[model samples]
Structure formats: structure tokens, C-alpha cells
Target: MITFQVKDMSCGHCVSVITQAVMAADPQAQVQIDLATHRVSIEPAAADAAALREAIAEAGYTPVPV
Candidate 1:
């Protein structure tokens, strides 16, 4: 699983958006968002961290390596 610290994800809506973005990129990916810590954890088929980070950014959030 790859984890990212998404600074802009502050609420439920943000979680949904990030979840959709990650799923759109990798359909089989398992995404978990923790609003308390502002962290997103994804278990994707492949370790495409760059693409994942970009997808998160495109979802209107800031994804920083964690």
C-alpha cells in the first residue's frame, strides 16, 4: 500500500473526491482516507506513486509523500 499526506482533504466531501480520483486511475485500488490525520492510504495493484499523487492533485488536494 502507498500512503500520501493530503493536506487539502479536510472533510467527507474531500474523502469522496479523493476516493473517486484514485478509483478512476486504478479501478481495483482500495482507498482509505483519514480525515483526522489528513492522510490517504491506497492499496493499488501497482506502485505508481507519481500517478497516484498526480491524481490526488487533480482532485484538488495537495499530496505530499509520507
Candidate 2:
């Protein structure tokens, strides 16, 4: 599992985008987001941590590994 702190993720839209990006990167990825904490956790089935981070970053958010 990988965890990231996405401080800019504030609403449902942010969560949706992040989830989509992660799924796009690894279809089997399990994504869990805590909007209140701005935290995203992913259990990637194939993608690596770096790839997951890049996917989130490409979605226009800063994902700091936690």
C-alpha cells in the first residue's frame, strides 16, 4: 500500500478525479480517500509507488508521499 497527502483535495470532485487517475494507472488498484484529512491510500495491483504518485500528479494535484 502507498499513501499520499494531497493537501489540495478538498471536495467530492477532487476525490473522483484522484480515484479515476489511480484506476487508469492500475485498474485493480484499491483507492481509499479521506477528504477530511486529504489523504489518499492505494493498494496497487500492478503499478508501483512512483507510477501511482505520477498518476495523481498528472491529475493536477500535488501528492506528497506519506
- Shift of residue 53 alpha carbon in model 1, Å: 0.6
Give the 10-residue window scoring lowest on summed lDDT in candidate 1. 43-52
lDDT of 1 by residue, 12-59 (tens): 989999999998888889898899999999999753989999998998
lDDT of each: 0.89, 0.98
Off by over 4 Å in 2: none
- Superposed on all Cα atoms, the candidates' RMSDs to the truth, in angstroms, are 1.0, 0.4
- Per-residue CA lDDT of model 2 for 1-66, tens digit only, reads 899999999999999999999999999999999999999999999999999999999999999999
